[model samples]
Target: MSNFLLQLSYLIGSITFIVGLKQLSSPDSARKGNLVAAFGMVLAIIGTILFHEHDGNKIGNIPWILGAMALGTVVGWMMAMKVKMTAMPQMVSFFNGMGGACAAIISIVEFNSHPDGAPGYLLVVFLGLIIGTVSFSGSIIAYGKLDDKIKDISSKALTYFNLLLLLAIFVVLGIAVASPEVFGHDVVWLLLGLSAAYGVLFVMPIGGADMPVVISLLNSFTGMAAAFGGFLYNNPVMLTGGILVGSAGTILTVLMCNAMNRSLLNVIIGSFGGGGASGKGADGEQVVKEISVTDTAILCAYAGKVTIVPGYGLAVAQAQHICHDLEKKLEDKGVEVSFAIHPVAGRMPGHMNVLLAEADVPYPKLVEMEDANPGMSSTDVVIVVGANDVVNPAAENDPSSPIYGMPVLKVWEAKNVIVMKRSMRAGYAGIENELFFHPKTKMLFGDAKDTLGKLVAEIKEL
Candidate 1:
């Protein structure tokens, strides 16, 4: 009867998980999805604890497990409560790395416990090891890049070296798995180190311009690693959940890459850190044009229609609220206000959307590039905030620009352009923006939040 109940509970949990995933498809259902998933996870955990052979046995200490659970609960709560919205991307990356690290550790522990290699377990272990190791290191590198602690590093020669190192490590791992006696555990440790190095090398060459895709790919790897670990342990729930997450994440990653017209190999091999004006101008001479904030405000206030394009810089400045505030003020004055959101605008997928949503911006006002581009030419003003690579006109005009061929917000088509920037420094892709030199563009130099707020005040005075 107890065994039957456990099985039933497990089945219910599985169903709940499925429903939760489906619910998560839309923002309206996301909260319910989270609740359902949490409930399912609870059920799964309870069922596992009750049905496990170690329950009330000499090997299992209930108190120890309970204590560990309590500690984990507190840590999770703190992270949830303390992490800011602006920091969520890096936090997500770190958590994903930790999850992958957990899966990797589990695989290593399980392998060491087996006296004779389980016939099919080696593949599962290898899968976990590779995926977890890669995810962990890649995520860390991503965190560093997103946080601006390390500048973008791109080198093809480095990629080649990483590939060679990975191959050598795998070969050693294969030999050690076949003959554990002669090679000793040192080979396993060496492989682990090399696997970590490979992860770093893998992400290092990829520029910050492609970070959102990298984050998605790393998330997929973490999910796959968890699934592999589940397979090794014959846990149906982990297998199902992991596979679902892995597949979904991979699809999202691919879509993001496609949105940028970047192939998986290109993302991995091409150093995309330099984003600016691509290619030589016809005369091979630099163009420098500047405008004032007062002129920009006048154009915006008098315009029949206007659009605001927000990017990572807006988030970095914690300026979403100010931006929203500015938008509201514009609307009150009868200026049309809308947001042009590029698919890869921020550090992660949907990052810009999430930030805007957090600021309580209306969903209707937020428009994707495809839907917004055609309307740009009719726009009276387009205000770009702390955005660089995404708005670089070179994407359309310069064949040699790193971002060429990738669709952008088309802000250049507007009657007047207002760009809020800190300096003349190029974006992560390290290229100059041709849009800055356009006759219609007015540069507002300051912190995004401060600049937008001041503009709001200045407009009211006008």
Candidate 2:
């Protein structure tokens, strides 16, 4: 009867996971979906602890399990509450690495207990170890890169070396699985070290701009590793959850790659955006126009249509609310306001969307790149807030540019473009923006939050 109830709980948990994932497709239902999924997970955990039995005895270590759960819950809740919008990507990478580490540890414990297990069982253990260890290490590196603590070490030689290292990992895996008796227990540690090394080197060369894709890929790796653990333990709930996470991560990664106009292969080996290449006019001789706060407000308030483009700097300044206020003010003046969102904008996928959503911006007003591009020519004014590479013209004009083929917002096509930035410094891609020198573009220099607040105040007085 207990086993029956546990299976029922797993079934309910899996159903909630599916429903929650579906609801996550839209922002309006995302919070509810998250809560529902979390509740289901908690239910599954409780059911497993109470009912799971091996042979004739129930699972032990209840006190330790509950204690660990309580600690993790407190730590995770605190982190989630304390994390800033700009550090969200790093936070995600760090948390995902923890999941990977947990899966790897599970494999290690299982392998030690079943050293003389069948070849199929040993294969699952080895695979879980390799994938989980790699995911953990790679995710840590990605976290460092996103947080600006690590620099990209891009080199042609490094790329080749990474490839060789990957090949060696696979070779070692094959040998260990085919002949576990030969190397004994030491082989597991050796494999762990090699996987960890490969993980670090794999992410070391990937540039900053490609971090969204890397994060998604590593998340998928963690999912895959978790799924292998499920297979090892024959746990339906674990398997379902792992598969859902893995497949969702994979799909999201593919979408991100497509949005960037780059193939997965290119993202892995190209080492794009290492920050060395100069822009079309990086010689400090190009002239740029500047506009004042009053002029910016006057222009936005009087324009028939205005579009705001947000990027990483907006997040850094925590200006989404003020920007929304500016939008509302412009709208009140009979100007149609909308936001142009690039898929790869900011630090992660949907970052700009999330930022704006937090400010209570309506979903309909946040236009995607494809939809927003067609209307750029008709837009009376384009306000770029803390955005750089997404609006740069080099993607379309310069063949030698590292981000040349990647799609960017066509804010330059608008009638008048006002770029809100702190200085003439380059963007995260480490390249100058050609749009700054365009005839229609004028720079509005200040911190995004302060400038947007000023714009809101100015528009209200008018």
Q: Write the per-residue lDDT of candidate 2 for residues 1-462, one digit (tens) a residue.
A: 999998999999998898898897876798899988998998998889999887868979888998999999999999999998778999999999999999889988888888877879988998999999999999999999988899878888888998998898788778778887777877778879989998999999887578899999999999899899889979888888889999999999999998888888999998876547665654768899999999988988899999999999999999999988988888788899999999999989999988898899988999999999999999999999999988878899888888888899999889999999999998887787889999999999999999888889999999
Task: Report RMSD (Å) for each prediction in the order shown.
Answer: 2.3, 1.7
Model 1 residue pairs with clashes: 273-429, 274-429, 274-430, 275-429, 275-430, 275-431, 276-431, 276-432, 277-432
What TM-score does each of the candidates earn? 0.94, 0.96
lDDT of 1 by residue, 1-462 (tens): 666666677777778878998999887999999899999989987877777543444326778878978998899889978988988888898888888888888878877776357536665786688779889988998888777786666555787787798788778767666766766655546667878888888888777568888888999999899899879867778887888889989998999989998897788766685233446445546555666666667777888898999988999899999899989888888999999999988787688999999999999999999999999999999999988889988899888887888888889899988888888787776776888888878788889998888888877777
lDDT of each: 0.82, 0.89
Candidate 1 TM-score versus the reference? 0.94
Identify the leading candidate in terms of TM-score: 2
lDDT for model 1 comes to 0.82
For residue 175, give model 1's deviation from the true position in Å: 2.7
* Runs off by more than 4 Å, candidate 2: 278-284
- Residue 4's lDDT within candidate 2 is 98
> Local error of candidate 2 at 363, Å?
2.2
